[model samples]
Target: MTEFQAKEMEEQEEQIENEAEDNKEAEDSAPAEEQTGQSEVNEETLRNKEEEIKKLQEEQDELKNRLLRVQADYENYKRRTNEEKIKERKFRAQSLVEEILPVLDNFKRALDVQIESEEAKSLKQGMDMVYRQLTDAMEKEGVKEIEAVGKPFDPHLHQAVMQVENDEYEPNTVVEVLQAGYSLNDRVVRPAMVKVNS
Candidate 1:
């Protein structure tokens, strides 16, 4: 073959080989494109799943916080109810003590009667015994007499019905108690009517 003809034949063969290689590459790249598209879809789905999980976690946290607040409110309500019950019990006891005061006064009136006869003496002794028993019973129920005759005059526990100028006692001191006062649990049920020294 001549030199020019041989060069033209070699150029034609190289062109054919290049065309075959391009066809093979196109065949290989088709599946790669499909795989890349699938991968993108999977990544988007994974992101959506992550977002859903985060939202669920946030909702759970909110519910937990609400439960804690409800528990706190319930505990406060229970505490207030208990305090009210205690106050109600105290008031009830105070009412019963007030009702018994008149009976105590009647007992005192009976004990104050003076008699000299033998039968009357026995009766008086019996009355004194009954009075002592009643007083002991009241004391056991948290009832206590207010101190007025010797203690300083306090308006909270004593009512000054009369005043006296006395040298023996200090000013504003209670000289005599005209009527007794009673207390229950450090709360005064009745104020003592008393004479104060000026």
Candidate 2:
């Protein structure tokens, strides 16, 4: 144990302490670096999740829009079908009324014939009531008679059987209704057989 030996031993101890401190610092910095890397990974994962959510929202919106369009189309289809049903019902009624029109005309002709006997007159009156009831039922179903006599003649509504020179009516006016015209729902079912003024 001389003084030179003691000084060399102290220098060796100081070198070992410095080496331990450096190792401790390296260990601390490694964890901090690891934490930074983990944070970056977490941020990337969060961004991916946000992107996925955005795509899903856009898909949901598209689906909702499509649903609304389909709903609207279905509603329009229902409305059109209902309208067609009403038109079909009107057409059916009109056809039946048209078939019965000849019978009504025959009844009118029979009533017009002169009858003097009491029993025949009574029968005529009963037939007239029946005709009126039939006409009333037809009217309720939107069946109507076309007014031809004394009115301005239209080729669409009247069929001209003949033309006559007359001062009482203007030219092309209907002077006589030889056969009754009929309409259903404002549409002509049968045109009036008419004599028009020349």
Candidate 3:
């Protein structure tokens, strides 16, 4: 071949090699750009998952609080109900005791009458025995007489129907018990009808 044709052929070969190199660089850059885009999508997905987890944790905490409140309310209700039951049991016999008080007073009046005849004395003895039995039964049921005479008058235990000036008792004191009063379990079932010293 002539020298001029050989030079032209070499130039064409160099141009072909440069074009091949450019194509290789473009292919390598395209994959790198795609990888960057994939990394951005992964970061967004991770942020969304973290937000969902936080919301779920908050909901769990709220549910736990509600459960604790319900448990506390149940405990309070049990305690209150037990207290009410105990109080009811303590006062269960109060109404029966009140009903028997008038009958007991009648018995006391009968025993107070003076009798001279032997037959009457025997009947009195029998009545006294019955009275004692009744009193003993009342004591067993937690019934007790309220002390009024010669004691400091208390509104809770005494009902003052009349006021009198008396030298034997201090002021605001109970001078006499007109009607007997009774108590059960340290609670007044019937307050003493009394005369108070002024």
Best lDDT among the predictions, by candidate number: 3
TM-score-better candidate, 2 vs 3: 3
lDDT of each: 0.82, 0.83, 0.86
lDDT of candidate model 3 versus the reference:
0.86
Which stretch of 10 consecutive residues in model 2 shows the poorest summed lDDT? Answer: 30-39
TM-score of each: 0.68, 0.66, 0.70
Candidate 2: pairs in clash: none
- At residue 69, give the lDDT of candidate 3: 72
Q: Please, what are the lDDT tens digits per residue for candidate 3 over residues 91-111? A: 888899999999988999879
1 or 2, greater by lDDT: 2
Which portions of model 3 miss their true places by more than 4 Å?
1-48
- In model 1, residue pairs whose N, Cα or C atoms come closer than 3 Å (at least 3 residues apart or on different chains), thus clashing, are none
Per-residue alpha-carbon lDDT of model 1 for 28-80, expressed as tens digits?
A: 86567567666476776677658767966776696578669768967997999
Task: Show model 2 residue runs off by greater than 4 Å.
Answer: 1-51, 85-92, 115-119
Those runs of model 1 whose alpha carbons end farther than 4 Å from true positions after fitting are 1-55, 81-92
Residue-by-residue lDDT tens digits, candidate 2, 1-198: 448756865875686578568657856765665666664767666776587679667766965786697689679979999999988987878768889889877877878899999999999999989989988998898888899988999998999999999999988899998888899888898999999999
> Any idea how many clashes model 1 has?
0
lDDT of 2: 0.83
Candidate 3 C-alpha error for residue 120, in Å: 2.4
